[model samples]
Target: MSSAPTPSRSVIHGDALEWLAAHPGTPGASLLTSLPDKAELGLPIERWRPFFQQAASLCLQAVDEEGLCVFFQTDNREQGRWVSKAGLVLAAAAELGVPLLWHKIVLRRPAGSRSMGRPGYSHLLAFSARATVPAEASSPDVLPELGELPWSHGMGLAAAEESLRTIRRASPSTRLLLAPFCGHGTALEVANRHGLDALGIERNRKRAERARGDR
Candidate 1:
């Protein structure tokens, strides 16, 4: 059997957007990240569009022509309105002229108890500076979402791992992975698990430390 990918070995404590702006990334690097949910930021959804646009722009600036960006996001509904974080990111990518390669659904089964209109799914969006190459194992358009692992409220480890695998399968030439809003480093940990070089930036010091602990 093939050996497992290398471990995620680095973590940075800072804001992802700022970090991206301060330190440029090499070409062919892949970005795997999940921005803070709309509710978590305590900001109105109306204010999120510009923020995501600037964030995407900074990330695009860091990568090369062949770089790929994989975004993991879920719905955030408040007061009966579902806020589409993925949509905003997509718009941001389009604004930057990045071609949207593919988008996949991650289906989740409700645990504990069910509520009215609560969704049991998330989205994984992939974009590239240019066209992307598909992999045989990465052809699935929808994947089963993984269970949460002691998560304080972020992307699931299993889900993140599978998404990273898919991204790598599509772009095997990508050498490094960047996560600007790494939150708790789920993406970074998954990157390391795949033995890919990765860097994660989180503004929350505690979350950043916890991300390292996940390793």
Candidate 2:
């Protein structure tokens, strides 16, 4: 019986935007990340929107042309209005001339359930500058539920798995996963388990250390 190859993980403690700008278009790298919400950044909605757009643009730009950039985001209600992170990401991708490869909805709560602040579903969107997914290679458009979350704002295990599966199919040459704003290393851990090297950039020192998974 053959064994799976061990993967490597490198967690950097610094601003994601700075890192992305400094290392754009990384070869053999794809992205799977969840951008931080306004609350986490301690910024007003007005300020956070631009920040989110810029972060999304950088993420899309950081990957190789043949690589995919996936985002896991949930919609939230702010000041009696719905704020859609998916919409924001779509706009960013549009500006960059990237095409949407797929958009899957992952249930945060059971179907037909109601929520107060965030919706009952989260968006799993993939974009690529040149990669294309054929109709025969399509996966589920909607996920039944988010498997397990490592933190309150981390990517779910099932979602991460699905994203990586899509990447494996769409971009077979992808050897690394880049995660910016990695909360608790949920995606990083999942990436390693899937035999892909993972690199994460986080602004919070404590969270960055935790993302390293050394202890």
Q: How close is every model to the real structure, measured as TM-score? A: 0.83, 0.96
How does model 2 fare in lDDT?
0.93
Instruction: Show the lowest summed lDDT stretch of 10 residues, model 1.
Output: 110-119
Q: Rate the local accuracy (lDDT) of all candidates.
A: 0.73, 0.93
lDDT (Cα, tens digit) per residue for candidate 1, span 146-212:
5575565577776777767766777778778887777777787778767788877888888888777
- Name the lDDT of candidate 1: 0.73
Q: lDDT score, residue 163, model 1?
A: 69
Question: Model 2: how far is 214 from its true place, Å?
Answer: 2.3
Instruction: Tell how far residue 63 is off in model 2, in angstroms.
Output: 0.2
Model 1: residue 52 alpha-carbon error in angstroms: 2.9
Give the per-residue lDDT of model 2 (tens digit) for 1-215.
Answer: 98877889999999999999999999999999999999989999999999999999999999989999999999889988999999999999999899999999999988988778789999999999888997878899999989988789888899999998899889988999999998788889888887899999998888999999865
